[model samples]
Target: MTPPSDPARIPGDAPDESELGRIAADLGLDIGAQHLAEYRLLIKQGLGGYSRLDELTSPPPTARHYDRDPGYLPGPDENPYHGWAWRCSIKGAPHGPLAGRRVAVKDNISVAGVPMLNGSPIMRGFIPHEDATVVTRLLNAGAEIVGKTAVPAFCADAAGLTGLEPQPSNPYDPTRLPGASSSGNAVVIVSGQADLAVGGDQGGSIRLPAAWSGCVGLKPTYGLVPYTGAFPLERTLDHVGPMAATVADCAAMLEVMAGADGLDPRQQLDLAIGSYTDMLEEDLRGLRVGVLREGFGIPGVSEPDVDAAVLAAAGTLARGGAEVMEVSVPLHSDGLSIWSAIVFQGATELVTRGDAIGANWNGHFDLDLVDFYRRAKPAHPAEFSPTVVFTVLFGTYLTEQCGHRYYVKAQNVARELGRQYAAALETVDVLLLPTAGMKATQRRTDGSIAQIVARALGNMHNTAPFDATGNPALSLPCGFSDGLPIGLMLVGRRYDDETVLRVGHAYEQLRGPLAVQPPKLADRR
Candidate 1:
């Protein structure tokens, strides 16, 4: 086909023939000269609508309900554990459930006026214009927003080593890692910097850190908490939940955070929010607990002492009058592979290519963030952490070679995985496992790419699957191994978070308080 001698060009800049040819080459399309002109005319027609849309003003920004300051970066004395990303105090409603409690929000969640780095230099100067749904909820419930906690870059690394400055180390032992992504939240909660916290989890970010830091973390059922205003990795697997020093505190936070906010397509409109704190009073009497056999004794990954400690914790549930039995869901062992494929590909598309806010979702999009990242990332690609670089490279390779075939297959398999867990949940109210296969590992100053990647993901085997399946899983300090905390995980049926918390609270009562002391901080007074 031949084009008309002169094409009707849009007033603004449009792709010329040379640029079009390059795009065609990139897409592997063979367009002869004659056809190229015809395609160019068609492309110009498409740009006309975009040009019209560009002239319109954006919708009004969400109104800020509470006052807050542009928080400051704390010094060594103020942030001894390096757990804080930024510090400021935003008091909420004068009276409510959390009236006087202090809360640390993971840096990934937006707090309107505060700088949110999301634990990466690439996002350095970006300040959100609106609060994340969870943040707003926390404020409405009368909690004080004390500061932003650190996270691994893009919340990708599990070791907590690959992010912005002031990376958090374990409160129990500064030489070891606290855990990743939600690393600083755990440290702050355990060290008494904050009474509670909000943490995001795609693949065990909340639970792993809470486990290693001897605190309580809950990855509420996917979409139970609206993810609006937070930097998302993958839509399907994204979750934001509560982390605290005790199960009761976690429940109280969840009570405030859970509910549909009219934004965030991730949340279902009809989903009912529960009174999570009330469930804490319920004993574990007659509750059936399944100790997942596959969750322990990984040939190379699980440490013997860690396994023994978790098994002992499960026995404590038995002594609390719950019926305990061994149950095996062999597919549980395959969760990591499934989660890896989804996160690697999905995050690459959503975060790297889509600029942290992907397309095809009906939710409040933070255009400012999208614009900032689009400009910043290209200018400083070298500043991205190792995990970010690997995901981009590997995901791009998979997309170029196999397309979304692997991701699709993994999603399909993930549904089966969910079914397998559901079938197990049919008989038992909760499933028990080691939150992490081993205790906190020593921080390595240097290593090969393989070693670094392994250290980042090695502890996620048992916890990652539940994220993929969208089940409510809680991790609490079960015991101590080699002076580090060992986490016991309790996973319940979808939306049955109350039952999970009930069990965890009952077990906490029987086990007594964790013997580990908070890391002594330099006195600020």
Candidate 2:
């Protein structure tokens, strides 16, 4: 993702007083002309100090070769599905758990030599020279790296459409969104292009896409899976997990990707987790499943059929011997606002600050992002999509103008939300809800930036709170509404990913496979 060049700015070596004034003005600083020129010289000297950072000292490309990058566009287009397809075969163990599995990674995760677009034009040519921790784990488990998938710019949108890359479409209907941020990962899975994909979720990225695409997506317990290597968006909210065709497959992928990588600070070294796949049994006898009351009733926003379908799925689990009951967490309703404050401020901090604020277990930072933020000044901010432009502006304004007061308040409220969910989990093994209010939405061709923000924000109502509270959440296709699939989310106690997976697996078995298939690839078999 290469930042578009701005002709008005002075080149790195040649610092112009006018350019410094322009930067200071954009930052809302009020410095006098004499001091400003001195400041410009100081800034130029400081910039000179970073010459070493610009040099790519990484070792040679690790993959077999630099492969083809199919552009976004479905049918006769280099990339028909807007799914970035490349071939990087780094075969691992001959007889590992994931042997023979074809896997796609969301672009945010480093693939060592593969260009990580992060679904933005800003990072276009930046190729990481080292594999992300999950990539190494996947290869160790014998999964073949098929390629990278499209992501929303900075993983901010849940629209499944990249602002600058190919807009990923629902395989069932090209007019519909494919589920976002992890849009390309879901696209490849439903389109039968890959067996599984490793996706990162800060909000509902993995699950949202999985639901729309009719696949299983899991956001592993916070810290259960290492976050080393993937780009960060709100450190506390970040999660990396697997999206697969089935619950069992997803579990297997998680088994391989989970556990402490030593480099991921989020992982608790002594945390004990069981074999998630083994927990998948036909019977849910005696398990208590709480149907979250607030999960529905979004008034005009939530579709009745979608809620009914999820409720029915819970009832099916009840019939299989699980005790189902309704539970209320009042704060659950405020998820969107809380998530927005925390994420916007935190993301703004990382984007605007030269370095990450939190502990870096992986000993790595996105120097590329820092480079972009400092230099990006196209006349129109040319390469940024309306959605990204909106996010950056919103985040930066909130961070700078409000001085992060909302961010602090959001974190305080988030703790209460976590406590509320924890208290409910004490009585119930897992909480269930409609993964989202509606099924896959039709891609809007005439949307304003406001509408795009609204759509993306709407998709996260049910999923973002868990990110804030650091819970294990999973989204699986419970049923279909109209011709598109609907997702049912199961949230478990922090560090209790197995319970969530078990409940989801049991429900998956009881409901059976979804009848609907992505229309475009239904005949692929």
Candidate 3:
């Protein structure tokens, strides 16, 4: 909590040689007794102002939405398939666009007075004192914050099966992964438990689950929705979006969710956001849909059925008066490598520095978060899932051996990739591809670390790039592959989320409603 460059204001008693020796050693300093005394004097003086940070307090909420005190309930196990962090019934405004809509908030996003597990055992008892921007917006719009849903540890898994609770099962088929990190968001919606869900996407968390769950998910342009209070992974890549059973519902949510809060530094002052639901139209007349020429060339990566379904979706749009064409942006193929260097390297820096880059953008942050990480991380490293452990290790290694130069290079190249996409967009309204090249992979009960990591990393090739390039991308059910839902990915230019949603709505009209319903919903209804 200490300010980065505050000068020492007062002196404290010098530490003893033994204490100094241990502290120095912990920092990789090997000071002998001879030099320890002088170092201790200097260190004690330098730390004199450290107590100033303790006087600071956590930020208070701007508004309270719960109609009644949110009492803690036993983790309800009504349906074992419905995995939630906690269950509570609460309502918001009596009349608004989302009134009467039941919604599930992802664990990583804060809800005032609620325990924010972030899908990690280490964060079990941590409670956020304020709501995330999205939560406040949703509450103001009259949506009930029904419960907190499950997520993979820190929302790190590519497959939805590893975290603090049982991974939310696929409503369609329990044997398959529902989707990555935002797994519960998709599952709860598909199961009829909630009408809409809030989800955050670093790579493909939002879309992956929507695809696998036979629903709609939108990862708006990187900063369109302020991430003022969400726990961050990589600041530049983090996105909070909506997931629902229909494109119109996703649009209605986005109408309230998007806009400049003047808090998230990621948001552009000149960015234009409008009523998204108003943009949804039944016809896509004269719109051009570009099929990325190189998106499906990877042999082992692209499954035949998945590819065919996306192409068929493109054809469906073509039949509905949209011009469909193939356009090549060769740099698209390099997305994974570039995304890896930036995300891993950036992630290492975020965790190691004990601070987030944009934490103060809103003039408030969960200072307890830093303290919690400080106390829990070293003490409970085992609490992280294998995928998160791998990411941390890989990131730490990259920072140590390669230094941050590679991260800088990756960021630089990412700008160029964005330009390439921008150029391609000038020729087409949106780019079409499979949200992921493959369909939902099988869920394993207890797999080896390698298998878990592989499962988490399997479906990121197509989606991760848009996260890096800051483009608006939406995934909606186009059809099913071997009975599992397949998603057609529609990507629009940065800040052009309305176009992407419009195209998706148009496509849905052409394809009609997808009939693949998860069996789990039958019993509940």
Highest TM-score against the true fold, candidate? 1
Off by over 4 Å in 1: 1-11, 520-525
How far is 253's C-alpha from truth in model 2 (Å)?
0.8
lDDT-based ranking: 1, 3, 2
lDDT assessment of candidate 2 = 0.78
Q: Least accurate stretch of 10 residues (summed lDDT) in model 3?
A: 1-10
Total clashes for model 1 = 0
lDDT of 1: 0.89
Q: How do all models score by TM-score?
A: 0.96, 0.85, 0.91
**Superposed Cα deviation of residue 296, candidate 3 (Å):** 1.4
CA shift of 372, model 1, Å:
0.7
Order the numbered candidates by TM-score, best leading. 1, 3, 2
Better of 1 and 3 by TM-score: 1
User: What shift in Å separates residue 118 of candidate 3 from its native position after superposition?
Assistant: 1.5
Q: What digit string (tens of lDDT, one per residue) describes model 1 on residues 1-525?
A: 111223233466557788888998998999777777778788778888988877788897777887777678889888877899999889999999999999999999999899898888778777888898888888989999999999998899887878777689998898999998999999888887888999999999999998888899999999899999999999999999999989999999999999998898998999899999887888788899999999999878999998999999988889889999999899999999999999999999999889888898888888888778877877786888878888889999999999999999999999999999999999999999999998988987577877777788778899889989999999999889778999999999999999999999999999996776666554241
Candidate 2 lDDT, tens digit per residue, 214-324?
889999888888887787877878899999888889999988988886666677878786788787774687789999999997876789999999999988999888999
Candidate 3 residue lDDT tens string, 1-525: 222222233345667889888998877787778998888777777675665664665456556666744646334445456556766666878889999898888889888888888888777667777788888898889998878888888888777867765668887788888887888888888887788999999899999989888889999998899887788888889999999988899999999899888777778867688889887974788899999987875668998888898999889899989999999999999998898888887776775454444333443455656666656666566677887778889988877787788899999999999999999999999999988888888887456888888888778899898889999999999899688999889999988888999999988888886767675543231
lDDT of 2 at 439: 86
